[model samples]
Target: MSDPVLVIGAGVAGMTAAVELADNGVQVVLVDRKSTIGGNALNLYKAFPTDDCFYCFEGNRWRPGIRKCFYRSAMIDQPNIELMTNTIIQDISGTPSKFTVKLVIGPQYVDPKKCIMCGLCVEVSEAFALESPQCQPQAVTYDPSKLDEGAKKAEQDCPTKAISLDANPSEKTITVSDIVLATGYHEMQPVAVDEYGYGVLQNVITQLELARILDPNGPLGGRLVRPSDGREAKRIMMIQCVGSRDENYYPFCSKICCVFALKHANIIANERADGRVSVVYMDIRTYDRHERYYREAREAGVEFVRGRISRVVSTEDDTLEITVYDSLLDKYLRFSIDLLVLSSALEPPEGLDEIIKTLGLKTASGYVGPADAASEDEVVVGEHVYACGGVLGPAEIPESVNQARAVVSKILQGRK
Candidate 1:
């Protein structure tokens, strides 16, 4: 029997690849360890270059013809794609064309297949409802322990009898023609850059954390406040390349950090208006079309300084003192700030070792790559495995999408 192609890590890259293949008459099984589909992109408020909102509509109400990213349940409605969230790849065996992939799938207390999503479970018991009411793969979740009274009530209340505390996790084996690994990158390791006062300082946060704070639906409700004092961050200092480009961590430049820093500066400029945003970087990398965002940031009065932070210390007055050597000025500059955001490195995701061991794949700087990249995109890694997106390296949304499509194209061509 012909099995669906398996795409691991249901990030933008994986989801795009799965959709492309499935739309082109190929069955696909998209899996991610996270309960929701969107990966790092979900945390983002806007994308660079255009500074467009990632998912929700931020357009003018009078204007028509607007489009947004897939932050909702549209993917769950696709007939050709099977989305398995909260699932992990346990082991792999057999050839790529006829591979048996072992998966450890977590139990969805309410089976989406049987769930009508009438909210009766939520009415009966709010015990295990997902954080967001707008969560994807709509199903009422329940906890066995909390459901002592609520479980039986929800079970009876549910229109489709989808609520069940007896749903136990089980190992599932799937046979697939190919495996597409799109495991995305992780945030900068703050513990490595201790001098930056990341975990040490309350207001100091990684760029990813800033993205979460900037997100309208995030914990802070898109409010720009210092994590330490809960006061509006009127003054912010952004330190670039926390882990990336540093010899101790990832030496290579993480291409996305510069633009992201600028994006944050722009946000503070627009939102706080009187906000003082200072960006200190060894070198400003606004390559190609992204230069506009850099110019916009500068025009918005966001101060750009050429320097690397030497140390970040706390002050007696509940403020952060960031010390950086300005190579351009040939002097050290100190910035007293309410919040300091570090644009850290994009390291490889977790479970990379497991992927390499189980699949016999090659890795470069923690990214999944062929034994030789020059071989071509379509070449099977070990026997029938493929990798794309940030798994191969630091890639932004556009590049990841292109890479995903490229992988699908190669797979389709090989099928014929």
Candidate 2:
């Protein structure tokens, strides 16, 4: 049997490469450290360009546009691709044409294919037996924890006999030729900055949390309200460049932040009829393909203040008082707001340094150094390794998918 190419990270670049290689009659093994595929992009509440719409957009908004899946389960459903979720490549080494990989596969009690998406397991277990408080709603997520009293009951309740409480598998290793690393980037925890008070202040939310609330399909269903008071917000302020462009935090500009802030402002306007939101930024870096999106946001009446926010304090009324220096006006202004959103910066994904170390890769200035001879537009590093999305650096959906297809073509050509 021919050796299969091992694509790590299961992100946009890796998925695209695997699909293209498999379509070319190359055996493909796709693995991700995460339990599911989507990488960071999947965890996101909504995608850009179309906002709440997930499926309508296809392809790169630029170039010969094509649709690419950024979500995990969606990628696994693709034909000609073998997705090994909850799998990690512990080590990788080989020749240019062939390689060897050691993979650790975590057990899945319930096969995702057999999952009927029925609520029966959760429904029955709750009444008949104590179940995991964190029992996932999806049928695909059968708890692997050792069987307790509650788990035993839930197992019997599975009409499909799909539940397996004691399904942990011992580690096994597999060898494959070639490797692609596409583990995505991580968001800098805004709380690291003492002043932002992310965890300490309930009303002071990270950008991602705000995204969830703004997302129509998110936890709040596009409703903009104070998590603290559950009341309609009268005034909201967004603190931009938090953990970004500062020597103390991150010394680089997180490319997508400006548009994301704009998107948040748009969400605020769309959700609150009487609320006013202001974004405080050093300068809006709506670069590359995000220009149009920035313009669209301005037309929607989102206020953008070019300034540097200095401090934030809770007022007597529980409102947040933000002090900023407006560059245009050359004046300092203090505003009281009901909610404060911090547009935090991007960091290397969780455990990225470890993964890079395992793969003998390097990162500089908080970015994984691209493969030798790699260009700004290319995501493929070697014969089988590819990276897309923010893993390559701060990129929007369009750039990520664009690099994904480019890497896909390179993988396909190599298979020939």
Candidate 3:
């Protein structure tokens, strides 16, 4: 048998590629640095276009048109695919198809197979907590730093004997026939952008943080409340292009921010009771089929301000007073809101630079670039090396999945 294909970053894109390749009888090693696999998609409350569950993926060929929950997919039981969580690439050597990759695998404090989602550990120890209700592995995660007597007692009393406080990190070297980089993007935290008062202000947050707040399974239990005083955030304001399309930060446009911001706005206006949303954007770029989001948001009574925020002040009553210069209306506008969300730029994940250098791959605006600029297959980054999803740049889930399929096609075609 040929060496298993190594797919890095077990986000939606990497998972899709790995699952597809495995279904086609190819062996795959799917690795993720996170304790679970979903990545940013796990936090996103709803996917645009379909507005369906973010975990919903195209089911197997036998069940076409059926959307299957990724958490319950073949990833866990698939014979051809090996799932590795809490793993990172330590080093890359050799070349192309014959590459030898060294991986440092973090210790698994809780055994997923034995875990029954009983929440026994969570109740006993602050150190042990479930990441999400839909988290893959369906187990509680443990933090060594938070270890206490309660943690020790919980480990001892674990019904399934899944808790292992003595677990240690391990390293392994493996050779692969092909390498696929799906190492996703990171949501920029606009702490440096003082004008928005992101870091210093309690109610100011990034889009992803707002996503968590809106998530039914999140800490706040889907209640849109102020972080300062835990009151309902009836009035919410979103600022677009927080760190994108600017000379000081990323110059390239983060293509999906506008659509998702509008997605949030529509949800607020239509779903939440007495909720009002106002968006401030230089330009609303909901390209292609996603234009409907902007339309729907407007139709749902969501306010749109074609301008930039000039000032943000935290009032004594824990509300935010914002000033905007409306370029379209040629006037300054002022408003007070309960929540201020910044649609910050999405950038390539950290540690991608080392991987790029190791693989001798090209880059575009800090994202993985096509090896041959003139080539039709943009996913191919180098000899026997390819990229998909957010690794190439900021992409929606569907686009990322399509790119994954393209990479899978290329690999399959090359083998024949």
Candidate 4:
């Protein structure tokens, strides 16, 4: 049998590539650093352009339905795929088609196979909690730092004997026929840009945080409330280009920020009661079919200000007073808002540099770049080594899926 193909990251792109390859009679080893597989998409409530659930996707030809969700997909049950969560690449060696990888797998406190999703463990201890209702492998996770008597009791009483407090991390070395880097992007926190008052201000949050706040399964249960105080955030302000398109940080356009900001704005203006949304941006780049989002947002009475935020001050009443220099109007404006959301830059995931260095891969603005810079195919980063999704740059779900398909095609064609 041919060696298994190693697909790293386990985000939408990685999962897509792995499932496609597995269905095509190829062995796949899917690995992710997180305890669950969804990555950033897990937190996203709705995808732009389509406005469907982030997990909703067109399943493979073998699936009964045309559409399926990540949580309910064959990711965990597929026989051709070996799923590894809480694992990271420690080292990479050998040639492209025959690379040896050392992986450090984190300790598994709760065994997913034995776990029955019973609430007993979670009810008994603060340390035991479900990562998400839709989390794949469907199990409650345990936090070692919060170990207490309650945790001990829950472990002892667990119906499936899934809890293992003394579990230790182990390492494994594997050889693969091909490597696909699907390590997704991370949202910049914008804490260093103190002018935006991100970390210092309680009500100021990033787009991802806002996404979570709007999620029905989130901590607030879809309530758009101020983080500082539990009051409803009726008047919300979003500042775009928090870290991108600026020489001080990442100079490239994130490509999707403007559309997603408009998405949130439309949601708030149309769905939420008495909610008002305004966006402050240097430029609104809604390329391709996403221009509809901008139009819809405007139709919903969402205000668009072409300007930059000059100052942000927090009031004692948990309101944020923002001073904006409207470049288009050539005047300064001040407004008090319930929330200040930052459309922060999408950056390469942490430890990506180490992976790039280990694999001797090329990079563009810290993201994995194509092997042949002059080539039109961006997925192929090296011989038998490819990349897709946010690892290549800031990419939307459709684009990421397409790239993953491209990688799959390349691999299959090579074998043929």
User: Global lDDT of each model?
Assistant: 0.79, 0.67, 0.90, 0.89
Q: lDDT per residue, candidate 2, 1-416, as tens digits? A: 66776777765556656666665677777877655455555435556765644333344334222343323333454465677777766666665566666677776666556555466655544322221121112244544433446556766776677766656755656566666666767777787787767878778987877877766556566778788878767788887889889999889888888888887787666556876878887888878767876676677777778887778888766778888888899999988888998888888777667756655655656566666745563565544555666776777766766776676676666656
Order candidates by TM-score, high to low.
4, 3, 1, 2
Clashing pairs in 2: 38-72, 59-66, 59-67, 60-66, 180-385
On a 0 to 100 scale, what is the lDDT of residue 165 in model 1? Answer: 73
User: Backbone clashes in each candidate structure, one number apiece?
Assistant: 0, 5, 0, 0
Q: Give the TM-score of candidate 2.
A: 0.85
Backbone clash total, candidate 1: 0
lDDT of 3: 0.90
TM-score of 4: 0.97
| Cα lDDT tens digits for candidate 3, 1-416 | 88999999888799889989998999999999989888888888887667865766443435443346643456787799999999999999987789899999999899999998899889989999898776886788888999999998998999999999989999999999999999999999888889999989999998889889998888999999999999999999999999999878899999999998998998889989999999999999999999999888999999999999999999999899999999999999999999999999998899999899988999999999999999889999999999999999999988898999999999999888
- Point out the higher-scoring one by TM-score: 1 or 4: 4
Q: Give candidate 3's error at residue 416 in angstroms.
A: 1.3
Which portions of model 1 show Cα errors greater than 4 Å?
A: 56-72, 110-134, 139-166, 376-382
Which should have the higher lDDT, number 1 or number 2?
1
lDDT value, residue 254 of candidate 4: 92
- Regions of model 3 farther than 4 Å from truth: 58-67
Q: Rank by lDDT, descending?
A: 3, 4, 1, 2
